[model samples]
Target: MDRQAPRAGFTDVDRESDPRFYIRCLDAQHASAFKQRYKRRTFDLLELRPGQRVLDVGCGTGQDALALAAAVAPDGRVVGLDFSRTMIDEARGRSRGKALPVAFVRGDVHHLAFADDAFDRCRADRTFQHLPEPRQALAEMVRVTAPGGIVLIVEPDHESRLFDSPYPDVSRRFFAFRNSSLRQPGVAHQLYALFKEFGLTEVAVEPLTEIATEYASIAHVAQFEGGMRIAQRYGVVTEEEADAWLAHLAEADRTGRFFHAFTYFITTGRKPA
Candidate 1:
C-alpha cells in the first residue's frame, strides 16, 4: 500500500473543514457510556492525590481536567492544554462559574510550556493518534512529570478497525484510507515499545476493544459517514461503493449481526522514584 499524505482529522481543529462538527463529535464521545468507563479508569490509574499538580494534554473541552481538579482538590491544580483556541475557548466556557482548581491553556504538545518535573502526574487520552510527532510528544509528557509520577495515555490503533463485510476489498480499501487519514493512527500499537525505549519504569499496557452492534453507536464517535465522504472524495472508494457498504452495515444491524470495532491501548509508566 502506498502512503498518502495525511489528511487526518483532529491534527489542527482550526483547519478542519468543519471544526464545530469536530467539537460536537467530541461532546458526543464524552457522553458515551463506553468512553465514560475508560475516562473513569484513567483517573483511577493515576492514583491522584490531593494537592498534587496534574496536566491533561489535548484536554478537549476540559472535561477530564475538571474532573481531575476535583480529585486533586484544596491546593492542587489541573491545567488543561490544547492547541486550538476554539477548544480552549469552549473549555474555558465549560469551566466557568466553577471554583475547581483547573485552568485551560492553549499550547502545543511537542513543546510543553512547563518546566521539567512540573507535574505530579500527566495524562493524554485519545490524543496521540492526531500527533505528527508522537515520540516527541510522549517525551514531553515524560519530561514534565515529577520523579515517581505516572504518565498515562490512551490511543486507538486505526489499523485494527474491523468491519464484517462480504466484500473484503471494500472493507480493506475503505479502512486503509481511513487509517491513512490520521497523523499517527498506528500510535497505539507502538506505545508499549516507546514506553520502554523512553525509559519509563514500571511500564504496563492494557487493551480495550470498543465494539458496537448498532451502526449509529459506533458511527457517533468514529464519524464514519464523514470518513466515507472523505474516502469518496479522495478516490479511495467510490460513492456508490460507500453507499453499498453503509447499506450492508444497516442490513446487518437489522439482522442483529452488525459488528464494528477497533482496539485501543491504555498505557502507563512511571518516572523513577
Candidate 2:
C-alpha cells in the first residue's frame, strides 16, 4: 500500500489514507493499561454465548475481534470489517497462527454488505465520533443484528476531556481546538437517545471513567504534543504559548501533580422482537 503524506494538523484526515499512523494510534491504545481494562468491561457487557455469530465494525487490527472469537469459541464465528483495506490486511495478518473463528473484510459501516438479521450481536468502538452521519451507521448496525440481539456502541465525548494545568486559557484553547477536529465531539452523550429514536428496545448507557494522575498513565505524551501542534496550526495558540504549556505539563509530571480525566460512554440496545 502507498503511504500518505503526514498530517499537517490534528484536523480530520482520512485514516484509511494513512494506515501507518492509524495503526500506531491503535497500538498506543492497546498498550494503555486503563484502555485494556475498559475494553474488558465492554466485552463483559456484550455477554457473548457460544455458537453465536458476531460482527465487529471498524475492527481495526482485530484485537477485539480475536477476543470475541475466543468468547464464542468452537462453534461461533466473528467477522471483523473496516473501510480501510490496510486495516483489514493488518487484522488478517494478526489472526494468523491462531486457531480462532475470525475473519476480516473491507467494508463500510453506513452500508453493510450483509443480509438483514445476519448477526447475533454487533458492535462499533470509538468509531462514531469520526462519522458525519452516525445515525445512519447505527441504523445499519441495528438492521444487521437479529431481533433480540444486542447492538453496542462505545465513544468518547471529547468535549468532556479535562487536563490539569495552571494556564486555564491554554487548556481551554487546546480542548476547543481538539474538539473542532471531530465531526461529533459530544456524540457519546447522545447515544442513548439516538438508540431510542431508532426504535431499539432496552437501551442503556454506562459511563466509563479514566483518571490518570501520572502523565504516562494517561497516555498523553503524544496527545499533548499533537494537540499543541494542531492548536498552533489552527491559530488557537501561538508557538510560544504552546511550548510554555507543554513545559508546565512536564514540570507537573516531574512534581507528581499531573492529572487528566475523561469519560467515554458505552450504550447498548436490543432489536425489538
Candidate 3:
C-alpha cells in the first residue's frame, strides 16, 4: 500500500482506515537519526527520574512510552494515552511480556482521565497541532502534573516548512492549502504564551530544524506526491504547476541542491508549587 494517505494523515487514525499509512510515516520519521536527536532532547528536558510517574499524551505507537518507562525505572510507571483504539492495541501488543513499567489507555486529551497532581511529569509530542482546542489539552496536561512537575510539548510550525523549488509562488499557495487542513498548523509558535496563560512557570522554548537533503528521505513522510495529488484535487494548484514543482524538487536533488526543512518547537514549563 502507498504509505502516504490521500490527505494529511496525523489527525486521523482508525482500523477501518489508514493505520498502516499513519504508522509508516511515524516509523520513517523515528527511524531517522535527525528526528531521533530531538526525541532524545525531549527526554532530557523531562528529566526522567526514578520512581516518578509520568504521562505521555497522544502516545501513538508507544515507542516513546517504552523509552519513558525505562527512564523511570523500578517503582516508577508511565501511562500512555491515545484517542485511537488501534494505536492502543498496537502499543499493547508491542509491550506484551515486556518488563517495562508502562500502560496504554484510550483517552481524550482535552479531558484526561487522570486527576489533579496525578503524575510527576506530563508531555505531548506532535499532538497539539491536531487538536481543535490546544489550550484545553494543555490545561489538562498541566492539571494532571504535580506541582514542580514538567509539562513538555513538541510541535512543528507548518508555515516554517520550506522546500527549495523554482515555483515560489505556487509553493506558498500549496503550503497555505496544506496548513489550512490542519486544526492549528502554527500551534508550535503559540506554546510559550499558552504556558504563561496557564500559570506554568520557568517556560522555555527551543527550535530545532529537521532538514532533508534527499527527495526520497522526506517524500514518504511528507507525502510529497500524495499531497500534491490532494492539492490538485482541491484546485489549490493546477496539475501542470504541481507537477512542475515536484519535478523541480527532483531535479534539485540530482543537482545536489535539494533542501526541505521544518522547524519544530520544544516548549517546556513547570507547574508552580
Candidate 4:
C-alpha cells in the first residue's frame, strides 16, 4: 500500500480527547498487551553494554528506559524523553529511589535538546509512525549519538500481515484499517533509504514475524472493535465503516479460524567514526 501524505505531528488531543467510553473501550482492547509485545521487541533490538550512555526517544512510560539502564549497569545512564508530561510523570514515579540513574525529561523528538555526540546509543520504537517529519527526528538522533554509535529503529508493517481465518475478507480489512491510521505510508519499506539519506552507514534491516493464534476468539474481536470505535471518534476513519469492518472480523473469529501474523522492521545503523 502507498504511504499516506504526511500530516501534522501527533497531539495530546488525539490521544486524550476521546469520549470517556471510547477511552475505556480502547483500554479493554489490548493496549496493555500491545505494549508488552513492544517492550520485548525494544529490549531485543537494543543491544546495550555496561557503561554505555543511551537515549530513548519517545520513551513512553519508560519501561524500555529502565531495562536499558539495567543492561548498562554500574556507570551508565539512560535518558528518557517524551512530549507528554503525564507519561514522564508516571515514569519518574516508577523510578523514584531506584538508584538506577534513569532520568525522564519532557521533550520533542524532532528537536532534541542535547549536545552533539552525547549518547553512545539511541533508540526509537513505534514512535516514528506518528511523527510528521520522521527524518528530522532521525537526524537529531544521529547528531546526538557518539561516532560509531548505533541507532536502532523499530516499527510495525501494518500493510503486511499473514492471517489464517475462515473468512479471508476479515484479514484483508484488518490490514487496510491499520494502514489508514499511519501518518506516512510504507514506513517499513523506506527505512533503508532513510538511513542512507541521513549518512548512517553499515545499515541492516531485520524483519520480525509474529504468530499469535489467540486472536481468533470472540473476546479478542470485541476488544479490537472497541479500539476501532475510538479511532473513528478521533477522525481516523468513518464510524460506519469501522463498525461494519469489525463485525465482519468478529464473525470470522467466532468460527475459530483466527490467526494473524505481521512483520516488524528492526533497522540498525551506525554513525561513522
Task: Estimate the overall C-alpha local distance difference test score of candidate 2.
Answer: 0.84
Ranking by lDDT: 3, 1, 2, 4
Q: Stretches of candidate 4 above 4 Å error? A: 1-15, 18-45, 164-174, 216-223, 226-248
- Cα error of candidate 4 at position 160, Å: 1.3
lDDT of 3 at 126: 93
Query: Residue 183 lDDT in model 3?
Result: 85
Clash count, candidate 2 = 0
TM-score of each: 0.93, 0.90, 0.94, 0.77
Q: Please count the clashing residue pairs in each candidate, in the order shown.
A: 1, 0, 0, 2
Distance from true position, residue 103, model 1, in Å?
Answer: 1.2
Candidate 1 pairs with clashing backbones: 8-181
The lowest-lDDT stretch of 10 consecutive residues in candidate 1 is: 1-10
Could you tell me the lDDT of residue 71 within candidate 3?
A: 93
Cα error, candidate 4, residue 23 (Å): 11
Q: How do these models rank on TM-score, best leading?
A: 3, 1, 2, 4
- In candidate 2, stretches whose alpha carbon ends up further than 4 angstroms from where it belongs are 1-18, 219-222
Candidate 2 lDDT, 1-273, residue by residue in tens: 212223332123244456578777788788987679878888988899999999998898899999999999989999998877777889999999999999999888989999999999999888788777889999899999999999999987778888888888989877876676567789999999999998999899999887888887654434687768767877788899999999999998999988888898999998999
lDDT winner: 3
Q: Write the per-residue lDDT of candidate 1 for residues 1-273, one digit (tens) a residue.
A: 343635756889978778878788889888888888888888999999899999999998888999999999989999999998888999999999989999999999999989999999999999899998999999999999999999999987888888888867988887887777678878888999999998999999888888888887876666667777777777888888989987887789899998888777899999987
Model with the higher TM-score, candidate 2 or 3: 3
Candidate-wise lDDT, in order: 0.88, 0.84, 0.88, 0.72
Residue 125's lDDT in candidate 2: 86
